[model samples]
Target: MYVAVKGGEAAIDNAHRLLADRRRGDRDVPALGLDQIVEQLALAVDRVMAEGSLYDRELAALAIRQARGDMIEAIFLVRAYRTTLPRFGYARPADTGAMLIERRVSATYKDLPGGQLLGPTFDYTHRLLDPQLAGDAPVAAPATREADTRAMPRVSEILTREGLIEGDGALPDDREPGDITREAPEFPMERDLRLQSLARGDEGFLLALAYSTQRGYARSHPFVGEIRIGELDIELDVPELPFPVPLGRIRVTECQMVNQFQGSAKAPPQFTRGYGLVFGQSERKAMAMALCDRALRAGEFGEDVTAPAQDEEFVIAHADNVQATGFVEHLKLPHYVDFQAELDLVRRMRAEAEAHTATPVKVAGKAAE
Candidate 1:
């Protein structure tokens, strides 16, 4: 039986007040604005939005501020707020093939159509901390060239045409993909649901699992077929409108990892693919997600599912940081009654053992007799 404990109300209120005070350190200093976070700390905001499963930049920035720069806490705030909002109809599938390309690169090809545009990447930057950034420094404008309006084709398509890569099979009956937000996920999930889960899954968890795969824990001999970061327009099908209504564009990152697969009896020897798509320019998360996605598909390809990443139930169950945090953090709550029961049982066992030991001096069968 559970017993409720009281009398911490005043303490709880005081603790909340202390938290507020701590959150606003140095009142003399100017407060941080939401615009500054949205523009300068863009990546952190992006992560909060992606993991929180909300796309509003302003809301994400506000959450970040409210959480005192705690990313996970900010994500929790965003998610909590998101649940209160009503759901609208799903948007049409985004066509990455026509993405307004910003940063596009391919490891497999030396140079592909729409030559590698290294747009605002830190790939070549030295990791040294610059002192200039500490103080007010004048930022120079980046040089730009005429926009490349040429069609940027996906790298996988080239391989697919030559029968060198596995093709993405058409959806059965062209059914709408499942929404995990609306329903609980089941084990042995379809790729669509799995991708949806991975898209919003904890980046660090996915990164570690992906790293494990690279270290021979379910290696697929993967290559970066393509990684693209850009903006894409979203369209929603309105029942009344004759045509799909256009929603505002959103920035996203897409990764396609090509893995070597020796042909099975049912299929020819060709390259397989793992896909990842995420909100904002989250290259690392997207890439890691793709690796994990490929690892999770081991069962489909008749490969042994021995690794943690290969276990669908394990990955899916532990992917949500919000849920994981809730389960873990809930331990901090009062468990007085439950703990008291355990304590009583332990003490009873100890007392019984002590009594038995003290009484044993009489000896079995009465040695004195």
Candidate 2:
């Protein structure tokens, strides 16, 4: 059959136009609004915001729509947009102790000072899909009696109160943070690199890695000290008070993992920490992240580490999806040029092999014998 293969520029331009048309959909149908996406696909927005490292709901909603609900694409979009934003002052660390908590749970304790509040979760729900969701649903409110905002101490606080558990404050300050982005990771990294890996690491990958550790990769037994969802105060550096000034509030999920620790000669036994903080109600990711964080701290604990999650170099190296995707997709851009070079090399090697076969080598000792 006769065929024509030509016009690369026109083909690419046509493809781009078609993509725009498909993304926009029919002319009769109105473009999906940001509010609609935000209201309907909140969880997607949450994931985008968490992964994108940005907190603007509107921006996140826009990214979700623009990326067509592909979370990684949404994250890429947000990150790209984020780079264009003006550099602002960094916010000081948010305080969890003073958080206006919505959901608080502790696996370590049955009952604690601050009672567990199961705010919004799918944990105990039956997996069966409901047909009633087709209609507009009524907004459900918490029971009036259960809405009290009483100040409550953490479950771990009781352990500290009785001197039963050793906190992170007990750890020696000899170890320093390793910067993963600025420098390449080396063996025997510090806690900072591990935390950074867990922070940006793929949720599923980190979960599996964390699971492997619990499934007997690492010897430490991790107890979820506290899983808290709340509004934490964002403070900014102000020269006036010599302290961080409270700027605003942002909702976050903070998971503090308390792992068993044995005392060494230099330091007394205490509960070493693995902390995970994420935007929104991503408790599972936070918990998984915390576990992975603890696993990665194996080197710091002076233990024989053999877990995939514990390899700081490997874990941190593969954690960022942005880096991973860029390297993986760059292969799609014009490798025919490289293929031609490789083809030339292979042809030359074949020609040399044919020449060598045609010219037989001398059999010296055997012929003489």
Best by TM-score: 1
Candidate 1 Cα misplacement greater than 4 A, ranges: 1-3, 354-369
- Give one digit per residue, the lDDT tens place, for model 1 in 1-369: 555667988999999999999998899988999999999999999999999989999999999999999988999999899889887789999999989888999999977889888887889999999999999899999997888677988999989999999886456877779889888888879888999999989999999999999999887789999999999999999889999999999999999999987597877899988899999989999999999889898988889888898999999899999999999999998887879889899868766766879564554434655
Residue 308, model 2, lDDT: 83
The best candidate in terms of lDDT: 1
> How do the predictions measure up, each by TM-score?
0.94, 0.84
- Model 2 C-alpha RMSD vs. true structure (Å) is 6.9
Error of 2 at 275 (Å): 1.2
Return the lDDT, model 1, position 62.
Answer: 98
The superposed Cα distance between candidate 1 and the true structure at residue 82, in angstroms, equals 1.0
lDDT of 2 by residue, 1-369 (tens): 434545589879998888778878789978899998877777777777887878888899998777767788888898899778785566765678898988898888877776777877787999889888977788688565646566777666777776667654333467545555457867665566666656766777777878888898876589998999989889898666787787788888889888887578976677767788888778888998888887777776788878787877777777777777889988997767679789899868766766788674455543586
